[model samples]
Target: MSIQNFLSNLDPRLQRMVLKNEQLEEEGLHTEAQKENLIPVIAKVTNIGKFQKITGVQKVTEITTAPDRSGQIVTAHIAANALPTVNKSPVVIQLQGAQPVKPLLKDTAREINLPSPQESSGNGGEGVIVGIVDHGCDFTYSSFRNTDGSTRLLALGIQEMMNDRTTSFQVYNSQQINKALGKPDPYKELQYPVDKYTHGTHVTDIAAGNGRNNKASGVATKADIIFVEPAYWDIPRGNLGNFGDSINFIEAVKFIFDQAGNRPCVVNISLGTNGGPHDGTTLVEQAFDGFVTDKPGRAIVIAASNSYADNIHTSGVVAQNGHIDLHWSIPTNDFTLNEVEIWYEGSDTFQIEVIDPQETTVCRVGLGELYHDGQIFASQEKSALNGDNVAMILCDVDREDMSTGKWTIRIHGSNVNNGKFHAWIERDNHTIGIQSIFAASRDNNYTIGSVSCGHKSIVVGSYDAKNLNTPISYFSSAGPTRDGRHKPEISAPGHGVLAAASLTGNGVTGMSGTSMAAPTVAGVVALILSEAKALGVNLDIDQIRTILERTARHNPPSQQGWDSRYGHGRVDAHAAVAAVRAMAEGRQPLPSAVTQEEKEALVRR
Candidate 1:
């Protein structure tokens, strides 16, 4: 694949950025200030030949080449003047930085009735791998060690931010990890810090960590683990910049899959973004879907996100020639600029007008137009908001305009007959003190997020183990995705679930959210794969999903079939393992194939 093909296929924001960098380079804008604005991107190619071609054209650096010759990973400093020429060549996939996906976590493992290590010893997930792509991990944690006190970690990949304004990837195998653990400072010995954020260790413990002192045992207790910590850069004002981007995530996934070799593997991703179209059309989503499709013994599980109760999403239908009004609540004391993205069917055209809380028209911009008013500027563009064909509104709020009231946005439909539009209030890990509300009759669905909305991935929602009567967590993101696909295929114990704490002496800790719920399912998948591998069978993703749904325990208020809130219901690991065993014995039929219509529908967005 050629770099030009990859650049052309990138998300529009990234495509535009790369093209702008090429333009600047052509104009001799090579000064430090000019180069500072250039976008850094990672490109994954099919082979070393394509990697060489890309590096020859751009200032590219190799991240890693797959040991199996499956692909090559490289990063490039895309300048404004060095855009590659497009030619007839193979299409190469590329991705850029997306909104950060955060950690969701823990509890009473007893709530889900996790089997004892002795009980599951016959199929103790020995031949399977549990891959965790998250923050840093605590390799020295007892939970990650074997009964002999040897490390159970198979490999580790650390994505580091270099001082040269580029990113570097360092991978360590079992020997290296064990050597580092033998040192006085294991993290320093490995030249990487411990799980300081603590998110990765907690998540990893929930999925495959062995019990420490007979406490906090995770699913797939015997499964080997592989982990990655994506690159992160801390910026000013308490914001984390350049962390959890799509590029690093893709690379991490590739690394895990390649290293798993012939072993059955399941990867758990508790991170997600609410930025892209709820339909999985982004390059990252497409790449993942392709990787998992038709590939038996491989799976990827993701968090359904914690956006359901955030009051940040508003959706409504626009009648032909009629208008709808949305109220955006801006906090009074915050002076930071905010952004809100509105998405509608590409075929439909609409107009948006913003009125200040003081009842003054501040600005109104239609599709592809930029509205500027000194410090307060607004803009709308087509296919520029996170690579989706939607209208985006960027608002730079002056401190004087932060009146802490409902700012009115009136949207008039031009050709909309039955088309619907969704507006999302952008959220960061830190508090920005802004909220959004729709008319009482409007706001209904809140079950959507980047990657979670993907068609093939298993998106897990959160439930409360402590309260069986109210098992569904209030924060769990529920979904009939934007494309009307029932998301969050299942729910799991996430609230107050106890797991290993990082950097502590055989410590146990508890956290809550869908992040915790996802790894639970990943661990169960490991168990299933382990059993299937023993039975000389390779389970497809669809088969694993069907087994889970069939064996899950339905919570109250949700029927036996799929429900938006609980998917097929709370995950039942014991029953799920039993079901896989039944399938192996030819007592049950395999899952039905995905219809061609269904396959096409996944990418329709």
Candidate 2:
């Protein structure tokens, strides 16, 4: 089917947006000079089976089945002439430019006093698979090898970007990866290289590394591993593109599920983005929730994000017919472009106006306006700005334009019932000359990033284990999601964690962040899964969460119950394992010593 035929079949509202996107592409709205990045649009088609039967359109690229069999997910290039056809589909979900999730990077797993592989009754995740979906991994690292020196990595899926701007997606069994490693350029033959970025290697080591050289062993030393490295292309002047999109994440998860077969798997995502609605409404978040649901022995762990100290989030409420001004301080010497997004309730409507430092009106967009000319934004960017019921402002401040200094955004309420909104500055790690600062605000709710905010995923916060009081890490993100759901459901030791280093074969290094903390939880979950498997019981996501929360070790003053800062509290692997054992034996688990009311009082104080 041609793009037009596919688009013609979509709902009228979707057809308008998709058509507008096509028009923008034809008009060269995304020219090189504009610096507007284009991303794939993921469509969830409920009647995919029906649509495929009538197929004459181009084959959908990067196709994956929705876990629940609800539909199919396919990626569409922004510049493609033909859009995929979904005739009379009940629902279609679209998202643009999910920012690349940066590594929240590490820790001493032993600090939490995890049980040793030999001491753990279930053979330390002997039958479970620990899937690390990050950058590439160092499959040659001895920590990933068996006693016979064979690789424990069951499979590897590599998503690479070719020079022609096409994707090179392939999956290889352990035998293929091992055979390729013997060649001069293993990556060329195997299609996936050893830990080029290093983050994946360290994370995998912490979760399932075998203790070599008498070093500290990971939580699930015997668990198999499945690694994914999504292909990414670097922009001419900026960092890599296509790194953080939801498509890659979903594809990675699908690959792991295929490889694991019947074995229980615990997937860890140490990377995250603060770009989307922190409420679990995005298509990617929903897909993740669907993937884990009803799939017993399957779970995903995500970092709570490292934006707590970044000061990029500002929140406020506007009264009826009232307006609020937000100041964003841009450093004087910075020259790179920046992005700002404002999210509000779906029922509320607001007008957004951006003013540069010199009081020039850069642009103004109303609630229902169509800013499709793309003079300053990509098609999806324009769609997100005008259609997603949010205000997305991109500031391209060059040194010559005097765009630096205090820029102001005025948000005027047009219709207000629930007038609250959360504004965030896009992460600028790769943009060398840009920095964003938002004026402090009173209502900074929903600071957690995407994927981590997923309702089904276990989001982990970080704490300093070296400190006697175990204070929450200053950089650990806090959250009661926009819709008011408690997040970072648990905290763990993330400060000064030592684990295997990717660059040196037998070397170890120390790193910190919620990234490191999440894998700690993932490793523990692996152990739990192993124990549960032995007991002949399959534990789902909710059961695992409850066991972890009940068995967690909290500080004296605030013992039981959930807190935004420390969910149920610091994770205790040994206690969690014991509790799982008790439950498996048909005996009641031990009760908490502290009462729920006391915990609430501590939170209030």
Measured by TM-score, the strongest candidate is: 2
| Stretches of model 1 off by over 4 angstroms after superposition | 1-36, 41-77, 80-97, 105-108, 115-122, 163-165, 195-197, 233-244, 333-337, 371-388, 396-405, 431-444, 590-605
Whole-model Cα lDDT of every candidate shown, in order: 0.67, 0.67
Error of 1 at 590 (Å): 6.8
Candidate 2, 231-257: lDDT as tens digits: 532222222223334566676776787
Separately for all candidates shown, the number of backbone clashes (residues 3 or more apart, or on different chains) is 25, 11
In TM-score terms, candidate 2 sits at 0.84
- How many residue-pair clashes does candidate 1 contain? 25
Give all TM-scores, in the order shown.
0.82, 0.84
Candidate 1 per-residue C-alpha lDDT over 1-605 given as tens digits, one digit per residue, 9 for 90 to 100? 10132443333344444443455566775565445543455555565356446422355655554323345545555433333331112434343444455554235456555655544432668889999988868898998988777789998888775533455678899999889878899888988776543889989999988786367578888899999887643211111133336666776787788888667889999887666677765546655765576368888999988878877778888988898888877665544545566778877778778787888877665655444443344444455223334544434445555544677788888777456888776664436434443324444365557777766789898878877585688888878877778888888888777777788847877788899989999998898888788776678888888877766665453565787878877776666665565666676452333222432332131
Error of 2 at 331 (Å): 3.3
